[model samples]
Target: MNLFNLIKKDQEYWLVDQLKVSHIPNIEYLVAFDKLLTEWKEQRVAYLSLLMDEENEDWLLKRRFKKVSSIVEYTKVLDGSYIASNTFQVEALSDSRVTDSDFATLYDLCRSGSANKNKLFSIRQIMESLERELGANWRDQCFIFSQDSMNYGISIPHIEQDTTDEGRMFYFGVVPEQRCKGYGTKFHAISLELLKTLGAKLYVGSTDTSNKHMRRIFEANGCRLRDIKGIYRIDIEKEFIQ
Candidate 1:
């Protein structure tokens, strides 16, 4: 059975499913993946990314998709066991009324780290993309945490809605100047509390294997290592542009 569905975001395509796509038989999954590629080509997709277990890397490599990175997924149950700092104030982006300055801050925070080279999005692009993915209430899910009137970072936490009470973060990062000051862990702790208010019974997070800092934050916050996956990417737009 085809356990996954192809999700399109602007010109990018994402293969999403409740379980790993590698769970299905190789032969069957291969045919499905091929069909997905054909659909992307026909739809003029600019990019596509798939996160699969290491066992599925060979086949993906054979399809000309580059192994960009390996990712580790972490999970934490929301039994109100996590504590957030009262010193920091939390403000939803929607409260800013979708102002240009707030979005500019979010853009800068998102691209502060040098880890991912694909931070090519403009401020307008970032705003438009989130609006499309999360709809009208997107601003409500986006948050900025501050202390003493200085913003520390941004977090976009969302629940799965009717499908599940599971929550995940679309983006989370500390500002460049504020890095290494223990704010990453503190911001994460606040994000967990926000998830609980959003009706999330559980929280799941993922980060690149090379990111020791994020991994440490996950561990420090009482999260367990759930699984690891390999990330594969095909940038048709870049290829065609070149």
Candidate 2:
């Protein structure tokens, strides 16, 4: 009875699968979640997070889950028509031989455009978690793009395991020094093409409402806005009282 995907980093975090309990009657999801919480208490899960659709929003709210932010979802069809750029070269992490210091620099680039004011995980935590989620070949899917030996940004493009043709840019960012220079658009386009090569026929992307840069990138890439979801969280260390 897997209710959510449990990811352990600096702390344990649960990504709730709303569809798993959608068939349950009103408040039944809450009952099921409560049982998992008790069983997982010794694991010290910091929090449980859920992207709320209308189906589970009402019941989730009843449990005093805090609405942290709203996420805008976008979708695009991959047509294998993307052309490679001659000006910039994209190198997969596995082939790039990025040193620890280089990785730290890349992590800094990701941190620069992060939407969360108080980041939940550290660099090591993030790296480990990504490896756990994406598996050993994660490096093959992570890439760095550069021009004239100067790096511009990074992108993690991969197909979602549950959906064969559905793809996602799990993470995408432009270095702080290169931001506002229109590199985000190019980087994202490259990622889309990369996903296509990975057998992705469609791409799904999301960004927080406050992330104007990312929102603009999605629009610039011509991705259609599909839906918006509320990001809700429950602190496991605290009592659940509404």
Candidate 3:
């Protein structure tokens, strides 16, 4: 078994990547990995990525590193409507699912300058987020659909706390030309219904505070803002250098 570590540091930050471990069989390896991670933390490393074999037992320990004091606040939306009479036509993703060819149309309408402005949530970022946040459990939970031949989708991530009755809904772009119609509502309602059925008492989502159109949509659909979290990033190496 080969274990590979890639460590890169610059004036602004340090990145550590550990990949290609065949099998991690014991606490010794776990302690060693922890020690290495601690050393990085001591060095003020800002970001770390671990790529481990899914079959390895040591992977269980990876959850420990999530204890960084930093927090990424998502703008949470809560769903309060009673689910008695609303008929939401929700469709789950399947092997034979057919998507509209013009997903870009929806993307342009819903995303466009927003994606370009934030320098975040790029196509690649969205794909990576899906993999990390939803891919593991999506087989049983995700929903996808198109608004009038334009594809749009949402992925929900389960929250750890049940009392909040919350889940996260991530909206991928909608078909562009189909905007101003009720397609966005239809897509969102369907997702909400599915969440309700899955025992989600409240659903939350986030967007830039400046995004009035999206905020309005959420308001129109009976979603209320629960909290606002500020986003921040620190370059450990930069701080160290300073």
Question: Highest TM-score among the candidates is held by which one?
Answer: 1
TM-score of each: 0.85, 0.82, 0.53
RMSD to true structure for each model, in Å: 3.0, 3.6, 12.0
Stretches of candidate 3 exceeding 4 Å from the true structure:
1-90, 98-110, 115-122, 147-149, 152-164
For residue 71, model 2's alpha carbon misses the true position, in angstroms, by 0.5
lDDT of 3 by residue, 1-242 (tens): 32334434332233332332336554445566567656666766565544333333325334432211211223334445433443333455443253322222333345655422233334544444444544565545545464454345443435423234666565533445555665556566556666666667667665656656566666667776654422222344543563
Q: CA shift at 140, candidate 2, in angstroms? A: 1.2
Off by over 4 Å in 1: 10-18, 21-23, 117-122, 237-242
- Clashing pairs in model 1? none
lDDT of 2 at 155: 91
Q: What value does the lDDT take at residue 125 in candidate 1?
A: 63
Better of 2 and 3 by TM-score: 2
Candidate 2: deviation at residue 14, Å?
1.3
The deviation in Å at residue 14 for candidate 1 is 4.6
- Candidate 2 lowest-lDDT run of ten: 1-10
Model 3 compared with the native: what TM-score? 0.53
